[model samples]
Target: MAKKVWVERNKDGSWDAFGDDGAHIKFGHGQGLFDPGDLMKLALAGCAALSSQVAVESTLGEGKGATISVDGTYDDELKGFASFKEQIELDASSAGLHNEDVEKFKERVQKHIERSCMVMHTYEHATPVSEEITVKQ
Candidate 1:
């Protein structure tokens, strides 16, 4: 079973997310920069990194440890208050992963991320936001 995840939105329009007793993550909400909404693409990249490992381990059988790192590019033009395009670059070791196998992993990770990446799915379809304001006269 996966660990529980929780997030608390902050005053600067950022959100802090915590997972299982691990380090907390702060997501920013900037227009031209990385924002809370942008987490979708990053989530795709991140999940792909781990999923690639899963696919690798399952295929190659257990041996030494392996890892994958992913980075993404989000088109600023299309990235409005809503939609955007996501591109991911994956890096891995050559021992357990051949060039063709790595390519396969990339494609597999992309497909799986589309189905399971929460942030992407949420933003791509529906976004629910609520604002609380206190005024002084």
Candidate 2:
């Protein structure tokens, strides 16, 4: 499947991004919308969180009381993200998982997320982006 988004520059120097699902986001200072970098961070964190949650639910039979936190730094020199870290916490006792089971579950979940997260995979293996400009007469 393929997804597409449209971004249009407004006259006031702001921009609006329209998704295929009728969702839109405004971008610019004072626009009350997320900037591009913020959106990237959100995507990375959200992917990790969702993947971890699913893994937890499937492995532990429930996902209650599980929390995932992700943080990273954008490197201008490298033109990419750096120092990405994700922390996942779960109350395995409530889910009836023993200590060994908890540790095994955490390891397996982390591995699955690292392998399955699309954003993380893209960040690791960045693809080249190219643009072509067209002028309307």
Candidate 3:
């Protein structure tokens, strides 16, 4: 894997971060397209998506046998701290899987991906956070 890198901000309430693909993600006293909490949700959803893909391929097989997609949303009241609603959804199709099997996939996602998502775990456990930002100028 590539090096894990991050850009940060000073404690006055600011942040600086960039995506590996060269996308800028920043925050300052409440700015930017995303925040810590939002990122966590995204991470959980992303993990679920990837894990589901892996699970589907392993369980069902590959080569035009099945197609899988996932969408996720989380409830703010459930997650707490984060007011924005997060919901996760899944869209899948398979030539070999019946409706029952699809349901099984959902179960697997609920049991494995949703349950094991790193961010989801963090949110469920309520982890502590330490933040600091220092200005360059």
Candidate 4:
């Protein structure tokens, strides 16, 4: 299935993005709003956490969760993010994962995210974007 989303500028000059599920996010150049770069980082972190959820829960117990953070520096010259770093903090001791087991679990989680996280995959491999312009007379 194809999903469609759009961003519209409000009369107050702020922008709101709408998704197919009726969720809206306030975005613009101001406080309490997310810019495009901020949304990108959020998406990356969310994707990583979701894609690795199965592996994490299976080994770390169902209730155990993790914190995933993504950071990147915006480059004015390039007008885009230079690079992104993703960090995941997980406590394995609760699940009794020792040195070897912990190492294996780390590998498993990495594999799961790398294999299934579409956002990370897009970052790794460049996806082409094309734009079409329309003029109202």
Which has the greatest TM-score?
Answer: 4
Please give, for residues 98-127, the per-residue lDDT of candidate 2 as tens digits: 779877887887887888889889888867
* Candidate 4 per-residue lDDT over residues 1-137, each given as its tens digit: 76689999999888989989898889987888888888899999999999999999999889776799889988999889989999998878768767899889999999999999999889888789999999999
- Cand. 1 Cα-lDDT: 0.60
Positional deviation of residue 10's Cα in model 3 after best superposition, in angstroms: 13
Write out the backbone clash pairs for model 2. Answer: none
Give TM per candidate: 0.45, 0.73, 0.53, 0.89
Query: For model 2, what is the error of residue 101's alpha carbon versus the real structure, in angstroms, after optimal superposition?
Result: 1.3
Off by over 4 Å in 2: 9-15, 30-32, 59-66, 91-93
Which window of ten consecutive residues has the lowest lDDT sum in model 4? 89-98
TM-score of 3: 0.53
Q: Lowest-scoring 10 consecutive residues by lDDT in candidate 2?
A: 59-68
lDDT of 2 at 72: 76
Clashing pairs in 1: none
Could you tell me which 10 consecutive residues in candidate 3 have the lowest summed lDDT?
Answer: 63-72
- Please give the CA lDDT of all the candidate structures: 0.60, 0.76, 0.59, 0.89
